[model samples]
Target: MTSKKSITRRLTLLFVTASSVVLLALGFVIASSVGKHFEEQDMEVLTGKMALAGHTLEQLKSQNDLERITHLLDNSLVGHHGLEVLILRPNHEVIFATPNANFPIELVSVSAAQNSRRPITWTQGEQTFRGIAAELPTGISERSRVIVAVALDIAHHQAFMRSFLQTLWIFVAGAAALTGFLGWAAARRGLAPLRALREQAQVVTAQQLSHRLSVESAPVELAELAHSLNEMLARLEEAFHRLSDFSSDIAHELRTPVSNLMTQTQVALSRQRSADDYRSILESNSEEFEHMARMISDMLLLAKAENGLVVPTREAVDLAAEVLALFDYYDAVTEEKRLNLALEGNAEVSADRLMLRRALGNLLSNAVRHSAANTTVYVRISASLDAVSICMENTGDGIAQEYLERVFDRFFRVDPSRQRSSEGTGLGLAITKSIVLAHGGTISVESIDGTTTFTIILPRAP
Candidate 1:
């Protein structure tokens, strides 16, 4: 593939091309005007000479005056260096001619045929001339009319024009070169902001994603680009931090159950145990294995949800009915804690039934585990023109304000000092948020006055 030219080179080339064209046009106009002016000056001189020659021809009374007239015309042109004259009778016989003047014969033929005084140009050997010819009436009886042709030598005009053209061409060439250099410099200076932006972007890596381009310092044309790049960098930095935290959380979560298994196995191997003792140890290890399995499964589900791989099968689902089903599943736990389950309102939504149930189940289980005994757990569902709202409120010692925003982060616990429990994995709220998001819904939590409420908004069935 052929390499493309840089912007600076392209701009410089275009500027030079345009400037050269304008300069050439101006030069042509100047040269043509000057040449025409020289012609006009020569024609004025030629016209005056023709009038003089005509006046001299009119003085003729007979053939006798012709000889004196010839002498008079010759003396009249004595001081003129490049002027020539010719006079002829009606019979085409030359009455007088300048010595070695060598005027073109075609000039006489055209002038006589047209009988015009308009100036014409012709070349004789190395000399160019502008001249005019006309028929004049004379006082002689038999020779009543004569041809008076006057010519001017224009060798000086030609020499000056040649010199002017050479100088014009030289100036145009120099100007083009100077303009090209200036254009390249201007292009380079104008693109300095883009170069700076590129340098800033180049310094960004996984470890240094916090670098941002300066939008305020950028040129107006590149300001939007710089701002967008800054936004992208911010997102990358955030994602990197989240990934780091996720990896650390996974390690922390797995270490507990693994340590328990190892400790139990070591204790069992330290002695020869009876069948009942071995059976008890194996059962306890099985519970730990089950907890690990559940944690791993939840992590995988969250991953799939984050990457948009969790596509839901849509159907019409009743939010109230799903809440009732969850209450039934947790009936034993509620009775054991002396807690009451209550629901209000009812709305239908288009969602994946299983995913929606799981999301609600996670919220319900969390509410049941955290609620105070003899308190009420309420589920409310409402519908609008476009959406359905499901809010789960439970009475408890409530989450603190500071930890509200991070409730949906994986493996995050409000009380970090608490030991890991088999009652639940910390991934419930995170997985619930992901599932709600997959169904084109939003979830948020608020805690106040010893009550914690988790509200979910899903699009309503059409």
Candidate 2:
């Protein structure tokens, strides 16, 4: 089994561990420093008392007064607990010592005198007691003067410091726990946005492409990411819509021809007939089928091109030559229809030859289909520094303003009832727009009065 990792838990653990380390170091320092100060104070008091006791013993008027001196000493030290005193000569012989039993009589500290005149100091039994030793200030009131010494117990001061440190450590540990808990809470609060982001991503799928993270409520750091995801979802939704519309368009466009073809095929095969009659019927039906197939193929091609599946093979081409060639091809038909095939100046542009041909061809077909018979359909190609435009204007029943924008939509028609019944795929304008867009160009239609013009603008040759 594995444990789940939590950010809050990690932050708390780290904070607590660091706090504990700092508190432990502080405790050690405080204990050492405070204990030293108290011990020094206790030693100073003991040293002073020792001197005073020696002076008192030496001030006695006669050697015969030893018993009186002892009694006075006992009375003086009665309330002074933990005090032990000893007096010694240069011969290391004891002259007097404190009667207090709570402290050892002479062995509390082994330190020698600080000088011939000052006391030495020591701490006893793991610093539980403070001790001082000194030469008894026994004066040579005579050469045989007696010495007095004292020891004071100091365990109480060290004990107080220890108790204080123990209580302080408990407080620090409690504060550490509280701070650790708070750190966990703060981490959780700060990371809430990330948690929400994760949950939202988990619930999202292609089915919910419309769903997007809310940038307004998200943290500033996540704002750009939320916006980018929303944009991607929007593009996907549009692509899906285009695919759906394209599928429906294909189904509607193929219905009538497929039904008619099936009927014609079955009927033509059902009965015996003369070979000429069979040939004529087969030929005509074959041409109709070919026309339907061509329309379907063109529609499919336009769909693929719009979707960017078919990339144009771009190249430099002589625009005027391509127009002239097309002019010759359509000139006979235009003449028979009494339309004018006009030529403009030569222009150069960078584009895909095949795609441009299709664009121009679609424009010519539109002109032929809509223009009045025996009237002039004018063609013009113009150029500037950065761009070139090919325009075709046909004299005809000009399109209504409302239908101008709708012309580029697949399967749409000016007449509502003929939308699905027209020979044209209704996608020629749509395909022209797609190809123009793919080539990094623009196309537009303008119609007023009896004039309808289609314009194609392409980038100029570099």
Candidate 3:
């Protein structure tokens, strides 16, 4: 909660402080210098008049005339001078004043005697004056009859400074506003290219992977950013292209082997042979063909998911039933691996039924293949109205912490030897992750010591 006045006040403080300091400093120096200069000049003129008056009195002593001194004094007070001259007798009698008006006589008498140093006093007219009094060196009056008073007016210099301050205020305010506006406008204009880049980035989709940031007509700094972004997009496009080609290549590689195995299995079943001979070949060939089919399908799905072609068809599904069904489907594999399978209580969720089933089947198969003999693998489902979570826990050699998150990446294998599971094809977890995400779910795996768990959480239907 800040007001505009506070903001404006803060901004003005620096200039205002500087201006006040400068103006006050100048005013002090000017007033001091002008007063000193005026005093010196006036003192010289007053001392000269005193000398002339003393000479006039000395000359008047030769003639012994009072009219001569009176006439000389009367003519001296004729014009409007910057300095006013007043003569007072020892009895405080006003003898003569230059441009005679009732200027306070005691002010002159008391101020001069009390403090001979220059006294700067202000009068009722709001004007500055300096006052001084000295005894005239005249020999005509023996009783020290005259106090020579000089008052210098200082209003013009004061008025000049006040007018300067008014003009300075206008200049400072106008400059601050003009500079602030120019700064704000320049900032907005300079950031225009970045705003354009953001708007263009909003429409970039996977299908339009070739789209790049525009560099033309951009500032040098923003142009560099544009070039870097374009390079990143090019790399991403290349990676996607290679992935698409690899998916096709994998399908071609597995389809021939699978087709031959399927054909041989069918031919053996069709011919008349002993049940055990046909059964052995049929089982061996069927397993090989089935493995090939599973690998091919997972690879295809991984490709489709990367291209964002798979959208989840969400519906309310009974998780307990789906687990039981997958258990039946892989019952032969589980028995062959010497592993026990178990399912937990019923859990209902909103998810893609087929995708969830495939993801579950992959997790179960991986768990079964990795687990030791006599160990149990559990498929558990927990649910509420808002969300459902499925966890498959198994007793297997757990993965390292570093490779846990990366296990869901396509074709990534933790085994440096690449010999632990050749039939895996490395796309199981990848496809599972893609499917879960399509249903607005998250999948993660955690392993500790010798237990690994793959957990999936999805939105549950009301």
Best by lDDT: 1
Candidate numbers sorted by TM-score from highest down: 1, 2, 3
Residue-level lDDT of model 2, residues 215-291, one tens digit each, is 89889988888788778778988888788888888888788678877888788889988899789888867876886
Clash pairs for candidate 3: none
- What is candidate 3's lDDT per residue for 1-462, written digit by digit as tens? 874553344445554555556666766676667657755775676566655555555554422353456688667645646666666766787666666233567777776566464553547466576556655545655654456676667567567657755565555566556555654465556667878998887767889988888899678988998898889889898988877767665766576666878778688868688989888887877767677677778777877886779988878888899889988888898788788998887777877789889899889878887788888999888877788889999997688999997888776777756642354666888888988888878999999988999999887752
Model 1: CA > 4 A from native: 46-80, 84-124, 130-151, 266-283, 304-316, 335-339, 417-419, 438-440, 459-462
Off by over 4 Å in 2: 1-125, 128-230, 274-281, 415-422
Off by over 4 Å in 3: 1-294, 336-338, 416-424
Comparison by TM-score, 2 against 3, better one: 2
Evaluated against the true structure, the overall lDDT of model 1 is 0.88
TM-score of 1: 0.80
TM-score of each: 0.80, 0.64, 0.43
Error of 3 at 228 (Å): 12
Model 1 agreement with the true structure over 1-462: per-residue lDDT tens digits = 999889889999998999999999999999999999998888888888888887887778877897667798988899888898888776667888888566666667678669777787888788888788888888786448887788888889999999999999999999999999998898899998889999989999998898888899999999999999899899889878877887898999999999999999999999999999999999999989989999999999998998789999999898888889999999999999999999999988888999889999999999998899999999998888999899999998689999999999998889877666734679999999999999888999999987999999988752
